[model samples]
Target: MGFLYQLGINLAALLLPVSRFFSPKMKLFVDGRKQSFAVLENQIDKNQEYIWFHVASLGEYEQGLPVMEEIKAQYPEYKLLLTFFSPSGFEIRKNNKIADITIYLPLDTKQNVKRFLDIVQPKMVFFIKYEFWPNYLYELKNRNIPTYLISGIFRKNQLFFKWYGGFYRKALQSFDHFFVQNDASAQLLKSIDFNNSTVNGDTRFDRVAQIVERAQPLDFIADFKNNTTTIVIGSSWVDDEAIYLPYLNNSENVKLIIAPHNIKEEEITRLISKIDKKTVRFTNYKTEELKNADVFIIDTIGILTQIYAYADIGYVGGAFKTGLHNILEPATYGTPVVIGPKYSKFQEAKDLVALGSCLVVHNTEELSITFNRLITDADYRNELGIKNLEFVLKNKNATKVIMDFIERNI
Candidate 1:
């Protein structure tokens, strides 16, 4: 199975140019590879010890960030090489100041992986969440470079737990240690006779905690909100918009800042057309005019984190679909969160709901009712918000735990 996987990877690399022509994202990957090696060489010298962190996309990047910052603080002598498997992560964060170098991980063919390892020669490697490339793992193990998986989660349905997934299981066993998100993941790994794991929770908790302590007031937003309650709709998808449209139309004395997942012009145009209340795109509004618009559509990227700081209530999107966006960002700000019904897979989401910090709704009507209750019932809102904030505060320091383990072992 491992051999076949490797063969497929090699085939993919060989045909990547063809794939690039068909897919927009693959084109970015091809373009990214052009400078990857140069970027690596620029930061990594033969004398310097380098640590490599690989994340699949933006969400995993956030999960791995606290640990990355810790490693930099503790081991200032070590160079950092950060790699992303997806363009969404690499493109947005390629110029991140913290990492000595940032680039897309080369295709996991034997040749590409060998070249990548040879150039950087990382002292240690960390894989965040779900990005496990078997060839990359095999090569790392062969080189005796320590590797760890941070904030990992597992399910019984994964290949590692299947009858014909011995190679996948072996690939996972290559990790020196696994700092998983919950006990379920630890137990699942142990079921397969893999025991070098710890339930350290998600490092994202630590990230969010740090965000809260350093939370700066958004003056522009504060002025816009004036004394009115504000609902922050974060990372909203089309499905989320359907449920939120009614609220936007009927609600008054409540400001709304909608930060959609895709802020392309077409999407923004469609949003403006559907909204019944006074609506303005963030890009178009001047500071003076911003105070009057009931709906502020965030037509740009990178402000979602800070926007949460101004939220009285938060509605995180992607729950309507199978995978969900980050809910902890808003929860860390001490805001009650509302989402669709598909949150069972996320341990934090389930825990938040149990702690009374979140409301789960299955459809538009339920969502409307929940929104009205959270807004009208001040005491209820404060109670839920306090619980959520406390939950975030308690779960911090995950990065410290993982870093301590890695520092000693490496």
Candidate 2:
């Protein structure tokens, strides 16, 4: 199995260039080494022990960030090297201020892995969530490096439970500890006889809870909302827009802030065209003009979190599809959340729904009805909002728990 895995890795390396033209993400993979080199060169003078954190995508990055921040704060002597496996995570976070080094994880081939370890020599490594690259884990174990899987989750039907998954199970065993997100995940690991595990709640709650404490005032957003109920549509996609556009048109005295997932010119144009009312793009909104507009489209990146400060309610997108985006960003603002039906895969969404902090709609009718009721019933909205905020606040210290273990173990 190990030999075949190595062969597959070599094949992927050889074909990476060929795949680059066809996939935007493949280009990032091919360029990862160069990006890593630049980060390493910039950090040559840094005099702190390095800790590497690898995340599969933006969601995993969020899951890992609270713990990473804690490690940096508690052990100022530790330098952080954050790596991403996906472009969606890397592109947004490449210029992030928190990490000493942020780069794409070099492809997980043996040669690339050896070069990465040679260059970074991270004292401790963390694979956030379920990123269990067999070669990387095996190599780290061989070198006696401490590797941990943080905020991980496992379901009953995952590959590890299959009869042919011994190799994958062996890779899981390489982690010195597994910090799972829930009791069910811990139970799953225990059922498999995996001993080094703990149920440390999702660190994303820790991250979002911190956002609430440090909420920065957005003057433009405040002025735009201007004492009216505002519905912040975060990370919307075409699937969500198809259902939300009609309802947004009919609503009144309510401000809409649409931050589409992809802000490409074509998509932005389509979004603007769909809305019947006076619309202002976020980039072009003047202070005076923004106050008058009923709707605003956020065409830029990086303001989604701050925008939540001005939101009275939140409609988080991506739930209309198979994969859902983060709902906690808006929920942290003490705003009731509305999402589509396809939210079963997202544990937070399920939890929020169970707590009455979020509502899931199937079609435009349910969305319209829910939106109308949530807006009209101020007391009900306020109650859900308060519950949402309390939920976030309650889970704020998962990072501290995980770090306590890391300090003791590492």
Return the top candidate by TM-score. Answer: 1
lDDT of 2 by residue, 1-410 (tens): 66777788789878888887988667776776566766676674445679899999888988888888788888888888898888888888888877888888877887877877877878999999889898788789888889998888888788788877788888887788898888888888887789788887789988887777787788888888889999999999999998999999988988899999998899899889989988899877788898889899999997898898888889999988777888889888889999998987677888899997899899999999999998999999999999998888887777888888887877
What is candidate 1's lDDT per residue for 73-168, written digit by digit as tens?
Answer: 888989898999889888889889879888988888888889899998898999998888988998899998999999999988999999999999
Candidate 2 regions off by >4 Å? 1-4, 37-48
State residue 264's C-alpha deviation in candidate 2, in Å.
Answer: 2.0
Poorest 10 consecutive residues by lDDT, candidate 2? 39-48
Q: What lDDT score is found at residue 312 in candidate 1?
A: 92
Top of the candidates by lDDT: 1
Clashing pairs in 1: none
lDDT, each prediction: 0.88, 0.85
